[model samples]
Target: MAGGNFMHRVLSYVINEVVVNGLANSPAFQRFAVRTSKTLEDISVKASKKRQELAEQIKEASRNFDSFKN
Candidate 1:
């Protein structure tokens, strides 16, 4: 049973390596990775801008509230 388990592990490792290498060398995968990264970067930029805008609005609202209290 030990030997059988060892063989299974070895086979699994080899198969995983083959799949990883194949995907790494694939052009389609490379393009997909680049596109995904670019999309994520764009989304990050947009979210940052929105967060800043929200912060500015909050500050403005706070100033307005303080003026009314005085």
Candidate 2:
């Protein structure tokens, strides 16, 4: 168990070190960061539009129900 734990820690450390070095010095990582940010922004916009459409649908349903009650 202890040996496994030691190996896991060493692997984590190495991965973290590599990521830090890459972010600081790698042009590829820079492009990756930009692309990731743009993708996230696109996702956000699509989510917002879907939310608005759902809200409108709920409002229409509520209005129809109110009209039927009268």
10 residues in a row with least lDDT, candidate 1: 23-32
**What lDDT tens digits, residue by residue, belong to model 2 across residues 1-70?**
9999999999999999998997979898899999999999999999999999999999999999999999
Index of the highest-lDDT prediction: 1
In angstroms, the error of model 2 at 14 is: 9.3
lDDT of each model, Cα atoms only? 0.99, 0.97
Clashing pairs in 2: none
TM-score of each: 0.85, 0.68
Q: List the pairs of residues colliding in candidate 1.
A: none
Q: How do the residues 1-70 of candidate 1 rate in per-residue lDDT, one tens digit apiece? A: 9999999999999999999999999999999999999999999999999999999999999999999999
